[model samples]
Target: MKKILFAFALSCIGFISTNAQSLYNSNSYFGSSSSTSISSTNSSVRYQQGYTRKDGTYVNGHMKTRSNNTNHDNFSTIGNSNPYTGSTGSVAKDYSVGAYNYGSGKTIHTGSRGGQYYINGNGNKTYVPKRRTRY
Candidate 1:
């Protein structure tokens, strides 16, 4: 009799657990997740980490200008530690081609004719060909 009662109780508990549902539902999440790294065309050091969702876009990345190790210094970089984070549209604002030079009165543009331009002051648009950083 005791064995039968115990088996019944165990079955009852198992049934209750099976019916329980998870508190956190995946439907509550916004914009499924899509993450990727943007690689530099010239070199491998420059990369961007972020997500591009069908609903919205976000980017966060870094540029390696300087190395953390001082003993094996072959090159020096700037703003490697600093991060760029914002909507994908934010890149447009940062890389304006028509950056007006209030002092020069001449507008500087980046990218080719096929590409759009946004001009910004203090925007140093320079590119250095990628090369071997290590021997």
Candidate 2:
């Protein structure tokens, strides 16, 4: 009878602990119970409502936005760190090559493959080929 009582007690404790963990993860935030995100081709927004992780890390409630040519202050850019991930941006400040100040107002922009490029008068990406190294 003593063995049976002890077994029951242990089972009850286990059940209670399991339920408590589930409850905390579902209702309380140290990690996400649920999350929402909206994204576009050029922009995105994420809302994390105070989630707690299983590893004991606490994620505070916050909203993140990424957009092109935004007028508001952007913390995800160079010289700033992302509040959620604590990662810093890597682009240099002088990344922009600027416009061709000769006469036309066409601005120079970085291309997808890490090449210096500018939109030609034909309205297309014209990548500047690197100088060939002589053998």
Candidate 3:
């Protein structure tokens, strides 16, 4: 009896060790990262002419300067604009109700009615006939 118990314990330990080693060796099956290269090259020439002083100072003529602007009031109007007008009259309708508005006057069924009705996550109503009650 003692020898049988010892042998069983030894076999269990050996089996556990073998399984652990196999799992350790299978690490490469999970995933591996290797170095990769990405390269892009384009050869094209684009040129544009702008204002330049006699002293060789180049100035961007196309760029608008804020100092010489005539429409500072437009900038003020945009900067001081309110994103939300705070009008309470605009009642937000539930999108789930929109599904019922397509001719079916039923709210989207959430699957809580365990009998013959189940509402799906999209709020669309579905009729699942109830199973026969077991007496």
Highest TM-score model number: 2
Q: Number of clashing pairs, model 2?
A: 5
lDDT of 3 by residue, 1-135 (tens): 997996686566556645644554453544455233311111111112378876699976331213221222111221221112212222112222322233233332324534234466666555432233225
lDDT of 1: 0.31
Pick the winner on lDDT between candidates 1 and 2: 2
Model 1 misplaced regions, further than 4 Å: 22-135
Compared with the true structure, what per-residue lDDT tens digits does model 2 show for residues 15-96? 6645644564453454455564311121244444788976699988664554444312344444444544567644322222
Q: Pick the candidate with the highest lDDT.
A: 2
lDDT at position 62, candidate 2: 65
Candidate 2 scores a C-alpha RMSD against the true structure in Å of 19.0
lDDT: worst 10-residue window of model 1: 71-80
* Least accurate 10 contiguous residues by lDDT in model 2: 94-103
TM agreement with the true structure for every prediction: 0.18, 0.23, 0.22
